[model samples]
Target: MAALSGLAVTGGTIAACTGKAKPQVQGKLLGPSFKAGHLLRKGINVVPTETEEQEVVIVGGGASGLAAARWLKKHSDKNILLLELENETGGNSAAGKNEQTAYPWGAHYLPLPNNSFTELLDFLQETNVITGYDAKGLPIYNEYYLCFDPEERLYINNYWQEGLVPRWGVPENDLQQIERFQQLTEELKQAKGIDGKYAFDIPVDHSSADAQYRDLDQLTMLEWLQQHELTSEYLHWYVDYACRDDFGSALAHTSAWAGIHYFASRKAEASNSEPHRILTWPEGNNWLVQRLRESCTDRIRTNAMVYRVGEQDGKVAVDYMDLRTQKYKRILAEQCIMATPQFVNQRLLSALPELLSTRNLQSFEYVPWLVANLTLKDVPHGKGLSLCWDNVIYGSKSLGYVYANHQQVALFPEKKTITFYHALADEAPAAARGKAYGSSYEDWKAVVLQELEKAHPGIQEQVEQLDVWVWGHGMIYPKPGFIWSEDRQQAGAPYQNKLYFAHTDLSGISVFEEAFYRGITAARQLLNTERA
Candidate 1:
């Protein structure tokens, strides 16, 4: 396990499903149908039969796009049209429902927000997550929405511990090393640079630009740990696990700045909740996305794929294929906010290549992820911590699973669903994505079962159904030097202040807060330009 630390798996083939399993167990594979979106790559030559003029057009329906639409709706009465390629507007934060409960496809929780994110707090208040402000001026969060007790647990050394950190059966020296690392992170959490700003901030762009801190981006997290002379097998596993959990990369693959930011960047404050406390729902972040969706529902168009983005008559013109009508549609707007991934932008904005000068598009490598939602007859009871909201298996390649219905207000659940997560970090992005796309439902089912069986022996018998979803381009990998690179910085720049970019990828971290920040920020930028 120690030897595998800081190493990636890179493009290993999934073994064919051969063994026999319980006859009651059945499963299916699900994900975004790439056929419509990929057709854009081949260049769509659809002529617009209809044209719609809007003051602002937002492309993509993810968190960023939704946030942009919501902000624009509240700030301006501009004619806005938001388009989404998928059947739904939630993007990766999409969810599904069964007779039992609701479950998430991607993001699941929002950490107690940083106090500086006043807009986010306001959003929370609108959603009732933040009920009101206290006498101390701290926000009062809804207790029901907060994660319940036994928040997390880890299966390590043949036992389940209280938390994800490997504490049980660890040697004294290793325990001390873990403590030291924790103390360092705690210190760095409040540590500010000479610029009078937090060394690491949640939005990432807001972090200090001090040379002392920015230099960390040049080296790998492993190198940084070694420089500090902190070498414990347990610590390595913890750090490597954290890097993979958040950035979808190993210590060696993750930038030192990104790795540390994972620990120090979040300092959420509230009157009743601690910094570690987070807000979640049965359907994960889809709850938040739904709130954003409601704010600008009339402007959002699903089953609409934007294929061409061009400048016409000193305005941004978007050409899209309407999946419902099977007709080409065009939207000419005074301003545009592109909330799609950088890769999609590369092709969509091919007409204006010079506008996107970020030449190292290859540097924006993404990691493929496998998520399995299993419906079980009953929750599996392991030796340690019964099933917590978030569960982990120490030294395992997978990030373990989470109880999809953990936030249920019901007294007890006889049957439940678990959402399993795995980042294919061992292989290169391209090769891994190819392999993931080529793999079969049986292949993924076999892989998921193999990992889960480690912690829950004979658990397959209890699984009534399993659904697998593969994210070909799951999340951005902040490899060493990529986070602070010039290409990344330029990638976020607004083109002529007419077209803007917004996505969690711009921050190199795929989290709800960053995506929200990118969306609201882009919308505000467009508003400022209109005023200017």
Candidate 2:
């Protein structure tokens, strides 16, 4: 069996290390309302006690679903209903709060947006994230929301480095390779194709169709690096880290286009702080989700598990289970937007799989993730560097942890929370997801501590509370040939002009911006159909 990264251990070694159990920690496991959705898999046969008619029904209250609801409410007075299986609306963007502070469950930050995204900027402006515009027409971001100084650091070579990219103790040759790769990415960032479109653009669908650059989509990021003779181990580690951080996949599994896109896609104009600095809060994206939820509060319904979606009597029928009532409910709508991931969509529309070809659904593969929020009385100070907002341990399978209170304005605090993230990119998606779902909190705690102890010896003693959340289908990985495939292009197609699909999966990259875009696009399509 292949040894895990950083640990350099076979499967047997892992068992040996974790065989001895320690004192139980003082926290519980929390996650999405999987039970509500899992009930559908057993086959829901309950008859609906109530039938309602809606102008539009949006399934899945993630970013896409919320965005669709907001757009529809703003454009038309038509009654719209948005349903979410989880108790909370913000899918992966969900957050939890304790007395000390609020921490993220999944997604944690949003980079500065390009001015081209007028709609997104408008939403930000409405939410007070973009306070005003400067003399140069640059967006003025609120200082409170911008990430604090001492933003990122990396633990490398038994010492904490100042930045995420390895600079300390790296050999001259490896350093040069890393610099050369940066130069290449910088050039690509400014590169434009013959059609006057960026070689790599966010929302990926807007990227240049010029085959000269689009052809790269057919190759793995690792293959692309090898072809460029940029094979430094340090560089490989850095690139793989970026892939895992953004797409939750390694270089070998990620598409070259998506890999390059991660670095070059952002072309945000110079802002009040920095050109492309990220904006984040203690609650992560849930802060944004709250603003979106406020726009259409009456239209949103949580704890509603959608089981089947089919067309009947010239309208789409959305059958869902009301978890509170333990009974089925039905919504007949003129138009429907499925904001759920393709995996869930496949099952919901299983009876109508021909509409969304099963072959297209097979093309998408989701990566699993483990996020743990450790409440600590005080974190053990590492050797050379203090706690930064984002701290990454070099060569570890787990991406270290983020200081959740890094953005807090309070001058003094006795307690703190650190959110740790790990992407199981080395294993097959299905196998990793199954193993993660089957494991208990103790099993995960062992895995997390084993990785953290490498950077912080005896750190577990400082932990007061450790809450773990597993994302069975965290996000889609843009594997080679999958990004530009015909199936992906057809995945977003509306069925009979009555059913529209909107989800980050349709964009081939899972990001807040992509999900928002898909939702708004689907909503606009519905409006246009109504007008026609």
- Tens-digit per-residue lDDT, 447-515, candidate 1: 777778778877777889999999888899898888788888888888898898888899888889999
* Per-prediction CA RMSD (Å): 3.2, 2.6
Clashing pairs in 2: none
Candidate 2 minimal-lDDT segment of 10 residues: 1-10
Q: What is the lDDT of candidate 2?
A: 0.85
Q: Please provide the root mean square deviation of candidate 2 (C-alpha atoms, Å).
A: 2.6
Model 2 misplacement above 4 A: 1-24, 47-49
Task: Estimate the TM-score of every prediction.
Answer: 0.95, 0.95
lDDT tens readout by residue for model 2, 15-105: 4554653444687777776776577667776657788899889998999889988998898987888998988799899999988999999
